[model samples]
Target: MTATTLAPATTEVLIQLRPADEWLAVCPLSRLTPGRGVAALLPDGRQVALFLDRDGVPYAIDNRDPFTGAQVLARGLVGSAAGRPFVASPLLKQRFDLSTGRCLDDESVAVTAYEVRAA
Candidate 1:
């Protein structure tokens, strides 16, 4: 029997964010390391934090920390709690749910969660 060869996987996947009506390409998926995040500046002057989970799921949220008003969420640490993925603020240590952008430490506080996709 003859053996068949398969094409090598490509890191051409692009991470996109939908801040408005259209989806904007942020960066290549390979640029995002699992459990780490990167910051992207939008056309409207808004900053967004993009993350890739260990499971290869992409998430996007407002980069600004609601409590301190600092744009440093991209530098936050990512992990999961109660089966929900979250990122802890580097400054205040407050955890924000990556899916919903809700502050896990405080139910009343939340940030904007953008719809993310891989294209």
Candidate 2:
């Protein structure tokens, strides 16, 4: 699946063996609680964090926090800012946009936002 990441020209596809339309299924929709997140490992060993908002909207992003390089985004707090959903990094408290994966505090940097869906 296609994901929006920093530097699209240099972005790498981690799950190569799977078909383009398929992504590693993290969990069932019912298993994801609101205001929380879950982490799933890709075939390439990279972890992707999946978040479902209180309103039942799903979002996916790289689990590693760019600032501290720790795999902890799934433990972040979920909330909304100005009607836009976001998650606060549990370590440094940096807020990230759920739909875009853009760090709200620093616009220059961002994590990868995966293409996800609930079936």
Candidate 3:
């Protein structure tokens, strides 16, 4: 019997964000670093923080910090609390949930959490 060899598979993963009705392609999946974030400017001049978890899950949230009014969420520290992924602001150390964009320290405050996908 002859042996068959199978070719390796290759998939080009892309990261996308939906701020409004249309989905915007930000960058390739390779551009993101696990446990870190990068900032991207939307078409409407809004800044967004993009992250890829160690498990390859992508998340996007507004880069603006409502408490300090600073656009610095991308530089925040990425971590998990109670199985929920969050990013703690570098300046004030307030944690924001990556999926919901809700301030963990303050329930009444929240930022815009964009729909993110890796495809």
Candidate 4:
């Protein structure tokens, strides 16, 4: 669930999640359309929302609504401020950074964001 850049000399670049000891792939990168999002359940039984920005960079966050504990972050609306992409909480209209998952409304909490790349 961490995002990191990798480089290998003369090798084709591929962005992908670090393989877990018992990991599963839920959705392919092709399923995400720019400026749109898709919700999927992980193999670990967690729900997550995956988004692609206007630049086609992928981001993933927990789908759970922190304010209401509802599984609605995936249904939340997406927008930008200045140049940062954020997702609004569907229940309370709070915004969170898509890259870091930091709650814009409350600095005390943050959701998990997974590292996403073209793979």
Candidate 5:
């Protein structure tokens, strides 16, 4: 009978499939001015416009123009509802939901909205 002992490997390998938190820091609140909108680049390479409503709360919405698929929503106009935040498309003047990414005028298409904060 023969007995053999195996030695353990000294090196450790670690692989991460996804980020601990899906959120990636985009910008600082100081850089994102209030009452004005700024374009934020996401980790996935998509752009979103972050705006602060008249009440000074932050809202985020896709930067793409829903009608033409162009990246022009960042240059669009920002307005408010009874209190809800919204962005108007620069191309066709269509309004979209800042929270749920739903088109106010159209129902079939939708953009994306991300959770935003002061950096």
Candidate 6:
């Protein structure tokens, strides 16, 4: 395996509420497994669920499930609907748009979506 070079992350963005700065290198791109979601604990103790597709495209959202109030979104099933990537809540089976964090089952309830990119 070859090692890739990246600019040092001098300052970490404290995302108390949601992620910020599109260029923020939160983690190594290689850490994520395709078609699976992983939980990343932010500096503020907030847990964010990050999903990667087979193509290595990344999506991030709150790890909590609104219906059950459980922090298990990271273990949800990943799929796509109408060309939009979504993650189905493991507890309620509610589909959440990974790009926007909109709940397909309930429009009023939504989670925080974060912008992610390969470093």
**Whole-model Cα lDDT per candidate?**
0.96, 0.81, 0.94, 0.79, 0.70, 0.83
Total colliding residue pairs, candidate 5? 0
| Candidates 4 and 5, the one with greater lDDT | 4
Candidate 3 TM-score to native: 0.89
- TM-scores, one per candidate: 0.89, 0.79, 0.89, 0.77, 0.73, 0.79
Q: Write the number of the candidate with greater lDDT, choosing between 2 and 5.
A: 2
Instruction: Report clashes for each candidate as comma-separated counts.
Output: 0, 0, 0, 0, 0, 0
- Residue-level lDDT tens digits of model 4 in 1-119: 99998786664433354335433455666677777678887767888888888888878889998889998887778899778899998789999899898998899989988876665
- Model 5: how far residue 63 lies from native, Å: 0.8
Stretches of candidate 1 exceeding 4 Å from the true structure: 1-11
- Model 3, position 70, has a per-residue lDDT of 97
Error of 2 at 3 (Å): 51
lDDT of candidate 2 over 1-119, digit per residue (tens): 99967765643323221214665555667667888998877767888788888777788888899999999999999999999988899999999998888999999979988877775
Q: How far is candidate 6 from the true structure (C-alpha RMSD, Å)?
A: 7.1
| Candidate 5 residue lDDT tens string, 1-119 | 89988998664321111212655555555555556677766667777787767666677778888789898877778776666677888889888878777888888988977766543
Q: Top TM-score: which candidate number?
A: 1
C-alpha lDDT of candidate 1 relative to the true structure: 0.96
Clashing pairs in 3: none
* TM-score, model 2 to reference: 0.79
TM-score of 1: 0.89
Candidate 5 residue 109 C-alpha distance from true site, Å: 2.0
